[model samples]
Target: MSRTGRFGENLAINGIDGSYGWPVIGHTFDYLSDTYAFGRTMRARYGDVYRCSAFLQNFIVFNSPDGAEFVLKDEASQFSSKLGWEAFLGRLFPHSLPTMDFSEHRHHRRIMQSVFKKQALVGYVPLIDQVVIGNLRTWPTHQAMPAYPAIKALTLDIAAKAFLGLELKQDTHFINQNFIKLNNGLAAIIPWPLPGTALHQALKARSNIFNYFSPLIPQKRRSEGQDIFSRLCQAQDENGADFSDQAILFHLSNVLAAAHDTSTTSLTITLDLLCQHPEWQQRLREQCLRIDPQDITYDNLESLEEIEWVFREALRLFPPAPQLFRRSIKECQFGNHIIPANTQVMVDCGYIHRSEHYWNEPTKFDPERFSPARNEHKAHPYNWFPFGGGSHTCIGLRFAIMTAKIALYHLLRDYSVFATEQARYRILPITKPRNGLPVILTKN
Candidate 1:
C-alpha cells in the first residue's frame, strides 16, 4: 500500500516504503523484538515518515521531533490521539484523559488540572515519603533483590495513597494484580474479549475496579481533601458540569494505572543506571543530602539539580512512554507529505531519544548531557518528550517526577544501591528488564 488522499499542494513520499515482514502480523514481531532497532532501521531506509504495516494498520512512521510536534500540537485540529490509541487503550480507559479528543480532552483536562498543581504536591509528597519508607524497608540488604517487582509495589503504594487518598493495605495485592492484567491486555494477539483470555481478564478487572470505587465519589464531593480523587470530585469544566460517578471511576482507573506503571518503570531504570554508575549515584546523593538527607520538600527538591538531571537523562534513555500515536482526523501537511484523514501515525520516542541527529553520543548514560552548559535536549523542542508534548502531555508528569525524585532521595540516603549482576532488556509492550532487574542493597 502507498500514500493516498493527498490534499492540495503537499505530497507524501511515494513507493511501498519499508518491509511489510509477514502478513496479518506485519512488522509486529520485528517491532516487539527490538522497537529501537526496528525504528532506526525504518528511519534509515525511508527518510522520516514512511508507511509500514503493524498488525492491523499501516503506520506512518515519524521518528523525528518535527514530526512529533506536527502530530501532537495540531493547531489545525487535524489529528486524533484518541483514535490513534483506540485499538490498544480505548477499551481499558475509554472516557479517560488519554483517550479523549479535541474539546472534550481540553474540558476533562481542565477539570482535573487542580489535582496536579504546585499546591497539590505539598500534600502528596509527605504521603509518598511515608509509603516509600515503608516499601523500601522490606528490601533485603546485601543480597540480590528483584528491583522491578519491588519498585512496582512501591509505586503502587504511592499511587494508592497519592491518587486515591487511601493506604489500601488490604486491596493492594488485588489492585496490583488487576493492573497487570490491564497492561497485559495490550499484547493480546487475538485482540478480542473471549473467555479465559488476557482481554477478558482485563475487562473483568476494570469492572471490579469500578465497583470498588463506586461508593467513594459522593464523600469526595461532600468534602475537599488533598488527594487527586477529592480534587477531581470537585473539578468542573468551563460549562460548570461536575464529573458524574461513572466519569470519576474512569478517570481514577486511568490515573492509578498512569501513576503506578510508569513510575515503577522509570524509577527501576533510574536505580539500574545509578547502580551501574556509582559515581552518578554518589553525585546524586551529595546533591540530595545538601537539602535534607531524609526530608525533601517541594522548595528544596528544586535544589537537587544534579539528581534532577540524572532523572531526566534516565527518562531520555528509557522514557516511561516510548511512543506517541495520532490518527489523521483531517488532511494535514507533515513536512513535504500530506497525511490523509483516517491514517494512523506514530512518533517513536525511543528512536528519537537515541537518534544520532539530536544527541552527539545518544546511547551513553552521561547525565551531564542534560546540563546547562551542554543542554543536548534543547537541540529540538520535541527531542526529549518522554511525558509527550503539546496539549495532551501526561497530566501526572509533575506527580511522576516528584514521586520518583523523592523516593530516590530517601532511597539514596538510606541504602547503598548497586546491581548484583548484568541484566538484559526488551522494548515490547514497554521497556522491561529481562531478569526482573536484580540489584544488591546495603544500608548506607
Candidate 2:
C-alpha cells in the first residue's frame, strides 16, 4: 500500500469508478424519475457494486442480497447509519433511533422496545379497530373514490389514536398536510430550505409538530396511559437516563410520521392489488367472513394467513423504503470492488425482490408465492425483507402487519372494491399511486 497526499493507502480508486452521467448531479435525477430503471442500468453496467451520485453525494450501491446482508447485518463494524441517513432524513428525524448508530441506537432501542411489546400491542388493538371500522363506515359506495388519500388519512388517524392516544380531530388537516410535505422532502430534487420549497415546508412542519407535542409531554409524564407517548415519557436507557422532554418530542414526531407514511403506503398497495385482482379479493373476503366478527383478536388475526400473504406480496412488489442506505466506516470489499471508507452506500432491496434470480415470474402479483405450498419467499431469506433485516429491522413491524390485517378484515367483509383502472405507483417519498389510484366501492 502506498500513501497518497490526503487519502488512505489501500485505495480502490480505479475499482470504485463508474460513469453515472453529468459531473456534479450525476444520476440523481435519473434515480428520482424511475428507481428501478436507474438501478437496472447501473447494475447491468457495474454489476453488484457501483458508484453514482445522488443528492449531491457519491453513493456506492451494493445492488444485491449478498451486499444487503453484508451492510445490514454489519458484523464487520464497517457501516454508520447516522452518517448514511444524515443527508436524506436528518432534518426532521434528527436524534431519532433510525438516525442513531452503534451504542446510542442500542440504548434508545432498548428503552423504546417495550413500547411495541405484547402488553402495549394489546392496548393498541381496540383503538385501531375502532378507527378502521369507523372510517370505512363513511366511505361512499357505487362511485370511484380515491384509495390512497383516504388510506393516508386513516393511517394518520390510526397514528394519532393508537400511537399517541389523541383525537387530533381539529388538527387532522394541519397534521396530515405537514406529513405530506415532510415525505415529499425525502426525494426533493433540490432538498434545501429554500422558502416555499417542499424541504422548507417539511422543516416548518417538523417545527410545528414539535411545538404541538411539546406541551403534551408534561401531560404524558403524569399519565398512566398505555400509548407510545406515555411509554416514552416513562422509558429510560440502561443507566436510567430518562429521555428529556425534547428527546421524547423528537423521537415521537419522527416515529409517528414513519408509522403513518410507511403503513399508509403499504396498505394502499394491498388495496390496489386486491382491487385489480378481484379473484383474490373474493377469496380473501370469503376467508374474512369465516373468521369471528371481531377478527382483530390475536387468535383470529393469525388465522387470516391469506391476508398476510397478500401483505407480503404487496410489500415485496412495492416496498415503502425501496432502498436501504448505509455509509462505510472503513474500507470494505463488496463483490469484486472495494468500497471506500465513509462512502454512502445503498442496498436496492426493491430490485432484489423483483430480480429473476430469486423469484418466479417476479413481476407477477402472486400471493401464492408466500403461501405454505409455494413459499417462493423461501428462495432466499434476504429476497423478501420489506421491513428490512438484522439489528435495525422496523420496531413496529408486527404492529404494522396487525394494523393492515385488521383494516383489510373490515374492508373486504363489508365491500367489494373494484379497481377503476390499472394502478400505477411511484416511490419518490412514500409508495403511492402516481395519480391517486381510485377504486369503485360496492356493498357486498
Candidate 3:
C-alpha cells in the first residue's frame, strides 16, 4: 500500500518540499495551522493529488473531482471519515454516532432515519415557524445587528423546541453557554479534560445535555409527540428492533448539534448574500408575503423556488462542513497511485465548489447559476456536494434546507439586511463568518 502515481510512495515531509516554510516539523505545522491554507498550499504545488507527511503520518490532498471520487466512491469501503472526526471530537462527544463504525454505524443510522420521517417533518413546520417569528421581534428596526448571533439564536431556539422539545428562548444565557462550551470542546485538539479548560466546560455541558434528555425520552416513548426526540424514543427498524436509552440519548445529541449548527451557518450566509443584493431580498420578501403568513406548512416551502436558489448558492460559497477527511482501511490503488492502509485522505469542498473547471465565474454570488438553464451543479454530481454524497451523506439535508428556508422567509420578509462597511471581515471554524457577521436590519 505504498504511495503510487506521479508523487511516489515517500512520506510527504512538510519542510523539505519548496512549497511552504515547513521548518523543523515540516508539513505538520501547516496542517494544524488552518484547513484553508493547508489545502490551498498543497493544491498550488501538487496539481491534483499530492502526498505529504503530517503528525507523523502520510496525508494526501485530493483537490480535483476525480480525486474525491477515488476516495468517496471508487474505493469508499477502504476509507473511514469518522475516524479522523472522532479523534477531533473525542473528549466531548466520543460516544455519538460520528464516532461509531461498521455494524454499529449501520444499526444507529437505521434507528436515526425513523426520526426524519414524512409525518415527523409535517408536524415540525408550525413549531419552527413560531420560533423564527418570535425571535425576529427582538431585532432593532434600523441598527445593524450581527447576523451570526441572530441566526444562531434563531436556530438554537428552533432546535430546542422542534428537535429536543425544550423551550430555551427565556433561558437564553443557559442555552448559549451550553452551545459555546460544546463548540469549544469539539475544537480542542488536545483533550480539554483539565479543570477550568474550555474542553472541561464542554464536557460538563455534554453531561448536562444528557441528563436533561434522560427523563424526556421515557415520557416521550409513552406519548406520540411531534418533536424529533419523541420519534427517536419510539424508533424501530423493519425487524421491529428498538433503540436502547443510551442510543437514544446519543442520537438526540447528534440531532441537536446537526440541526442547530448547519442551519445557523447556512442562514447566516443567506442573509449575508441578501444584504449584499437588496433586489433579491425584495424578491424573496414578495414571495413570502404572498403566502398566508399564518398558515406556514411544509408544502408552502416548495413554493419558495427562488429563495431555494439563494440558499444553494450560499452553500456553494461557504459549506458548513468545508473539509472532509477519511482514513484508508486497506491498501488500495486509485488511478495510477496506490494508497497505503491507514493513510488519511482530505478533500476541500471549499476549493472544489469554487473551481473554475466546474463552475463558471465561481467566485461571483449569482443564484441564476443554479437555475434550470445553467444548472452549474449538473457539470459534476460530486462537484457540488455541499451536503456530501454516497452512502454516508448527511441524513438530515432535507431538514436543514427546510429549517433554513423557513427562517430566511421570516427574516427577509420583515427586514432588509445590509452589511456594514466593516462587514464581510470575519473568521471560520465549524462554519465561515468566524467573526459574527455584523449587518443593518432595516424594517422592510
Candidate 4:
C-alpha cells in the first residue's frame, strides 16, 4: 500500500486484460472515507457495472437501473443480506427476521406483517397524533432548533406509545441514548464486542429493551389491549402457529428499531427538504389544511397525497439506507461478465438516483417527479428503491409513510420551517445532517 493517491503497479488485476483494480489496501481507505466518492470514481472509469476490492473481497457494484434490476429481481438465488450485517446486528438484536432467509424469513415476516397492517395503524392513529402534538407543544414558539433530535424525540415517543403501548417521557433520555449507541454500533468500522465499544453498548441497549418489554409482553397478553404490541402477543399464522415469548421479543426489538430509526431519519430529511423548498412546503401545508386540521382521522391522513409525493422525493434524494450489499451464492455471469461465487455485490442507490438516464433533472428537488403525471420512478421500478425492492421491501412502508405525513401535518399547521444558513449538512450512510439540522420554526 503506497502513501501516494495512485494505486501502484503491484496492486493491479490480471484477468481483466489491461484494466486494473485496487491493490493491497485497494479502495478500502477511499470507501471508508466516503463510499459515494469511490462509487462515483469507479462508475466514471468503469461504466455502470464495475469490480472493486473492498475489505479484502472482490466486490461488484451495479451502478445502473438495469443492473440493479438484475441484482434485486433474480430468478435464481444469488444475493444474501445476512452475509453483510448479520454478525453485528445479530448480537444487537438476536434472531431478527432480517437476519434470516427463505422459509425462516418468510415465517417471521408473516408474523411481523400482522402488526404493520392498515388495521393495526388505524388503532395507532390517536397514539401517533398525541405523540406528535405533545412533542410539537414542547418546541419553542419562535426559536431555531435542530430538527433531527426534535424529530427523533417525537418518533421515539411514537414508537414507545404505538409499539409498546407505553409512554416514554420518564425514560426518553435513556431510550434516546440507547438509540444513538445502537446506530453508532452499525457505523463502527469494527463490528465486534470490546469493552466500552459501540457494539458492546448496543448489546447492552438490547438487554435494556428486552428487560423493559419482557414483563409487559405478558401484561399485554393478559389485558388484550388494542395496541400493536398486544396484537403481536396473540398473533398467529394461518396454520395457527404463534411466536414464542423469545421470538416475539426479538421481533418487537427489531420492529421498534426499524420503525422509529428509519422513519426519524426519513422525517429529518423530509423536514430539511421542505425547509429548503418553501413553495412546496406551502403547497403541502395547504393540502393538509384543506382536509380539516382539527380531525386527524385516517380519511384525512389518506387525503394527504401531495405530502406523500414530497416525502417520496425526499427519499429519492436522501434515502436512509443508501447502499445495499449482497454476496454471490454461486458463480454466475452478470451480462456476460463472470461474477465468481462469494464475490461481494453492492447496489449503489445513491448513484442510481443521480443517474441521468432514469431521471430528467436528477439532482433538482422536484417533488413533481413523483406526481401521477410524471411518475418518473415508474420509468424504472428499481430506479427508486428508498425502502429496497423485491421480497425484502420494507414491510412497514405504509406505516412509515403515515408517520412522516402525520408529523409533517402537525408541524406545518402551527409552525413555519426553514433551513438555517449557519447549518452545514453532511450525508452519512443514514441521511442525517452531520451538523444537527438547524431550522427556524415560527408560530404560524
What C-alpha lDDT values do all the predictions have? 0.81, 0.83, 0.73, 0.75
Superposed Cα deviation of residue 414, candidate 3 (Å): 1.9
| Span of ten consecutive residues with least summed lDDT in model 3 | 1-10
Error of 2 at 396 (Å): 0.8
Find the 10 residues in a row with the least total lDDT in model 2.
2-11
Model 4 poorest 10 in a row by lDDT: 1-10
lDDT of 3 by residue, 1-444 (tens): 234322232343232233423443446556545655666666777676666644333566677887777676634487776664644555555656666666777787887887776777888899999998989898877786777887888888888888877776577677666766777666554443788876778888878778877977779888767788777888888789888888787777766776677787788888878878888998889988988878789998989888899999999987876666677767777666667666666677878887777789988989989889889888777788888755567888888888877988888878777888434422234564755878888776
Which portions of model 1 miss their true places by more than 4 Å? 1-16, 293-295
> Of 2 and 4, which scores higher on lDDT?
2
Predictions ranked by lDDT, top down?
2, 1, 4, 3
Q: Mind giving the per-residue lDDT tens digits that candidate 4 earns over 225-261?
A: 7667887888889899888888888888777777778
Order the numbered candidates by TM-score, best leading: 2, 1, 4, 3
Better of 1 and 4 by lDDT: 1
Clashes of 4: 0
Residue 118 CA displacement from its true place in model 4, Å: 1.8
lDDT of 2 by residue, 33-108 (tens): 8887777777778777777766666677776788888989898888988777877788768898878899889988
| Residue-level error in angstroms, candidate 2, position 215 | 0.4
lDDT of 3: 0.73
lDDT of 1 by residue, 1-444 (tens): 444422121124234265656776778887778888888888888878888766455667788888888888787888888888777787888899878898889888988887898999888878888888888889899888899999988988887777878778899899999888877776666577999888898899898888888888889887767788888888887778999898999998888877788787888888889888899888777776677645657877777778778889989988877777878877677667867667778888889999999888889999899899998899788989999888898988888888878888888977888787776876656566889988888998
Q: How do all models score by TM-score?
A: 0.94, 0.95, 0.89, 0.91
